[model samples]
Target: MAEQGKAAEGRIRIGIGGWTFPPWRGRFYPAGLAQAKELAYAAGQLTAIEINGTYYGSQKPESFQRWHDETPDGFVFTLKGPRFTTNRRVLAEAGPSIERFVTGGITRLGAKLGPINWQFMPTKSFEPEDFAAFLSLLPRDCDGITLRHAVEVRHPSFACPEFVALARRHGVAVITAGDSPYPQIADPTAPFAYLRIMGTTEMAGGYDAAAIARWAARARDLAEGRVPEDLACAGVPQPPGPPRDVFLFVIGGFKEANPAAARALIAACA
Candidate 1:
């Protein structure tokens, strides 16, 4: 399916953070042969997709199939485990539900599945001892398949060095994220790297080509060879402004920054 993906020079993956549209069936869009063609059209520019919506609930197989068929090959799909499993506040004890959610998400996507993002909420105080132990229990096999795993921790404790050590030990990627409230994840060394960029960040979220260029410059530096070793921990930063082709994930949220980011990415990549 990726065979049809238009190859653009200075290409960089650009996409929205998660599904926000209510309608799924092919009503809003035409190009997408599946549920949401508009989303698909947006996804066309992105080489990878981080499905944050799935983290909230389970998606039907039909929905998953539709998404898989609409996209081209070489496209990476990063899914977030349900919040019940990921959010360690009241739902931390919900182990059975967690397993079910993870299994369902992974199985539904099948080959399209990439890393399952386990993003923790900011409420829970970071407790590495319990947290790390719980994370260790994640089955290496999901629905009889082994997949890449990445964790995005919101608690401050996650920023410490110990968290990095634990993430590296496991085959999970240490997500690099830039946010407005606080910068949670960092650029660490691992087999895989998960990155998150907020379009609202005062420091990074401006519709300025210079800002996008700066972010792209950083991404190009990190994307250099030796990605496998860094995959576990290494990931490029998110390009500023609208979703751009300069970085792996040019996330454009509800902001004018999306197009701005896109412009900057095009310039830097050019």
Candidate 2:
């Protein structure tokens, strides 16, 4: 997939939400392809994948190890944080669940582990103190491996300067969710940037050529630590810093065409 590695400015990884889909059997996957070989085949086509299964329940250590062994080098997987940890009344009390998730054999992924996405419910509003406490519960490292965390806040209350400041203080990224009802916070809060774009089904490749070109340019701007002027920012503009790694995933809308959209973005980035 266009030589998965650091670009001229910074590393850019493009992928889809998950690898397993029934519709993809004959469309994305070849006809009569074995189910066991799906991950391997998908990994060969994309640089990264966001694992949504981890959000539902805890997985066995062997499962994580097997996934690691199946994928090739330079491939990475981003896990969705368990719902029990994020879907709570008092976020501060989620420490125990958070601890369980972080220590639940995730380190088995080794170098293949990307960021852990802690997605909050749309009904959850931004309580500065409680949100800060929730961020504090996230560990910086686990089993000698440095961990990266990203929060996907769907509520409109998160579109504020205070929220951005809080995230920046903890060095946790705020996911840029595109083409969804969720508020799109494009501020750069962490060392790396995370984006999830949902392209329309009307277009053959999820998005038109011009739209893909615009997203590719935005991805490059994020990688080089320069916020794109076209995107909305809640906080005051900051000076450009060093290059940062970027993770972009094509999700939702026109699910079957997501892989093609990701591949197109990868080629554009190259």
Candidate 3:
């Protein structure tokens, strides 16, 4: 009940991309931990996880239920929207794909389900009308569960104020991608903030202590509805609102050190 109360009031969640990395075995995972216990172990350590496999293919309903049963209460899973839905010529024509993916029994995760990230190719340019149409296709609810959507646009074309305005108009969060070549958009457009931080291999725990401290501060600012002045904002500044939930994933950098980074961030936030 305490966990549910914290979740309801909005809290910061730090986690890694996925739990199935071979490198994590004997490093993040115990030396002789069974493969079947990986998810449970990861869940115990991290507050959330971004499931990258769903971006490639669909999973059975039992898989979702199993994931929910394996994890503790308040653990969240964010899924990547399928490539078939986002890697298309016409964004507006992706209704069927979106519907299929959303209705594919993901509700089995119940309260454990978090945001659904729709990542676009770097080559995909921003088309305001088409993009707005695509945002409209994202349903507000699925099987009585409220759904939150976040967009990960990698192209430089999406760095414009118009794009931010469009996302804000539809109440979809723009992902803040760190330590990558992708254009980072830090505008807070929704009720929550989503960040994917990729730290370097040179630093221990995927990030130096100073960097982790900075990220912790930034996460707290976002969680409290105060945008950090250090980050770039493409849209005009808006007044701070009520505190919002934050989901931060340590991904794409030193893969082996991601768990350590996430743990460090969690400690810093604490």
Candidate 4:
């Protein structure tokens, strides 16, 4: 990892998957808050968000710009790479589709755009050559701005040294999926780290205070480039690398408890 401007203070951001959950209207969100104000409100609470809608379809430039304008400075939105490409049968032939998605209006988000997550299905087993070809299609920059990439491979076959080497070669982060049915990877291959917390309680707040504290410690370790021994990672053990920025998100454990989970994580980290 290269030196970053925010590394000194530990650039760790905690957030939820998305902000438009109707269940949160009266639970996590204010009772009378307008639906349109949800993004703005959520942005004020969390440091970053994972944009899942983009995986379904392309969004307009205007929508991207509006999201940027609504958020506070330094807030970021990590987009899900369109399923059209990832779900295709031949992963190697997804270049054009990848181009269209990359050159789309996503650049309108400018500095607010974070990592692009290319999530593979649980059945998508590790195919070194094919997966490497797909990774080759990812652009380090969109237009003139730099972009980061992460791959969320669910199949257990991905938990191998070869997969780790491929990702490290491409400088793409392998998502650290916390408590999921999917394989958890803590390689920290990219310049930064991206995490998805899949297990949260159905309680009012997503996680209990103890869990929140544990996650906070994990976040601190990530920012400081210290990978915990407990987490699973592919390949042989390696020494701790330099500190880098970290982006953490709570992805659908208890849907309504997401906001509270994010807030609690943020407070614990602070």
Candidate 5:
């Protein structure tokens, strides 16, 4: 494992995926990014975060600067590429938009950023070949920032060995979620695994018992790998080496027990 940063580098790291409570925009987030930092501070025990709201558009400089200033050092942040970067838009339509959004987000995130997720919208006919081509088209230099990249394939056509091969080939981490179809394609060898466990139906309705156990186990394995470093590649040598500190995010649980669930998972993970 790499020499760790400040926060405790567990075998695996954990946090709530996000808090998209609609109320934030009107009250907590009158501006946007600055408010998110404050919200992050309030999440209690979270050491890292993955921001989804930014997927809608690029953030303003002032907003991002607030993020840079407010977050405790060693806070890892993962952000999904904006809609313009990954929607069903034609290549012609997507090209420019991708450039703009990626450039903006990278600049905004700067050093705080970790992974950039490209979550595909599931469609019946989205085959592997076409998807492979799409993956190829992504600019290696997104916003001049070469952060860890990941992709989540929701279409049923993506659940196959070939797709996983393509992901590894492109250095794109295949996201592991509690969602249907996508979960079927989980890759254990990914550089950093991410779990978006939630209550959504697309995630098989609610959390499954076995799925939670899988998450707990993964947390243990990854935390063991961290060894107290922010980035986990210091002396990691080669394949089948210790797992990097993955993010096992509880995106959902019973609404009432959300906090309790996070704590329980954290304890089990410890």
Candidate 6:
């Protein structure tokens, strides 16, 4: 009952990119904690963790099942789609790779499967026809579970109306990444929101109270189906809709401090 109530106010999940950070071993995890218990420990601290390992390679069903058993209920994992699918030069040829990833042991996680983040190289720019063909390959349902997709296009060329319209037409969220060398486009192109905050410094507690408060407001705005105008890279008009779910990940920069940053944002959301 308590968990349901908390989820009802807004399904804003705050987390870091991955859990297997060496820096977190002593700072976040207790001293002498078993290395294998990292995910469980981290899941207890944050609402979700982006599965970055999968971006590099695939995992077995047992691995996914174990991850499902480790996390608490309502916890989710925003998986990075395999680079084999998103890193290809000819985007149209990525169909088989996409199928392999989608049909991989991912569905073994069941409801714990959150969003599949299809991150492209910073050099990859928008090619309407090619991009649309790739988006078409994304499965609406993997096995029997519904799937959610988010595209993390790093190039500045993606910050355009045409790109936003294409993503919206396909109901795929255009990732609103935080401080980066690439464009941090913050357009809500889908029913859900995905953010990768890469600006955390080594400041005390990762982010000061003020910064977390501001981010909390932004997460709240996204959950309410509104865009935070100040943070948006493109000036697209807000799409009309009811409130939506949100996934916020603290990643990059002072990577060691990401866990603290995630906890701070989660507290601010409370």
Higher-TM-score candidate among 5 and 6?
A: 6
Model 1: lDDT of residue 3: 17
TM-score of each: 0.72, 0.97, 0.96, 0.96, 0.71, 0.95
Give candidate 3's whole-model lDDT.
0.91
Q: After superposition, how far is residue 124 of candidate 1 from its true place, in Å?
A: 2.0
* Candidate 2: pairs in clash: none
lDDT of 2 by residue, 213-232 (tens): 99999999988888888888
Off-target runs (Cα >4 Å) in candidate 3 are 1-9
Q: What are the lDDT figures for the candidates, one per model? A: 0.55, 0.91, 0.91, 0.87, 0.57, 0.86
Distance from true location, Cα of 8 in model 5, Å = 13
Instruction: Rate residue 115 of model 1 by lDDT.
Output: 68
Q: Compared with the true structure, what per-residue lDDT tens digits does model 1 show for residues 1-270?
A: 131112422234444455445432232234345444555664565456677778777888677777777776655577778877766554336568667866664566666666677777776666766766666767677667776667766656566666666676775666666433544554444444455666533234344555565655555544442222222232343232221122245453434344335434544554
Give the Å error, residue 49, model 5.
2.1
Against the true structure, candidate 1 reaches a TM-score of 0.72
- lDDT for 147 in candidate 2 is 99
* Candidate 1 lowest-lDDT run of ten: 1-10
Please give the lDDT score for candidate 2: 0.91
- Candidate achieving the largest TM-score: 2
**Considering TM-score, where higher is better, how would the candidates rank from best to worst?**
2, 3, 4, 6, 1, 5
Among all windows of 10 consecutive residues in model 3, the one with the lowest summed lDDT is 1-10
Of models 3 and 6, which has the larger lDDT? Answer: 3
| Poorly placed runs, candidate 6 (over 4 Å) | 1-9, 233-235
The runs of at least 3 residues in candidate 2 whose Cα sits more than 4 Å from the true structure, single-residue gaps closed, are: 2-8
What count of clashes does model 1 give?
Answer: 18
Task: Give the Å error, residue 190, model 2.
Answer: 0.5
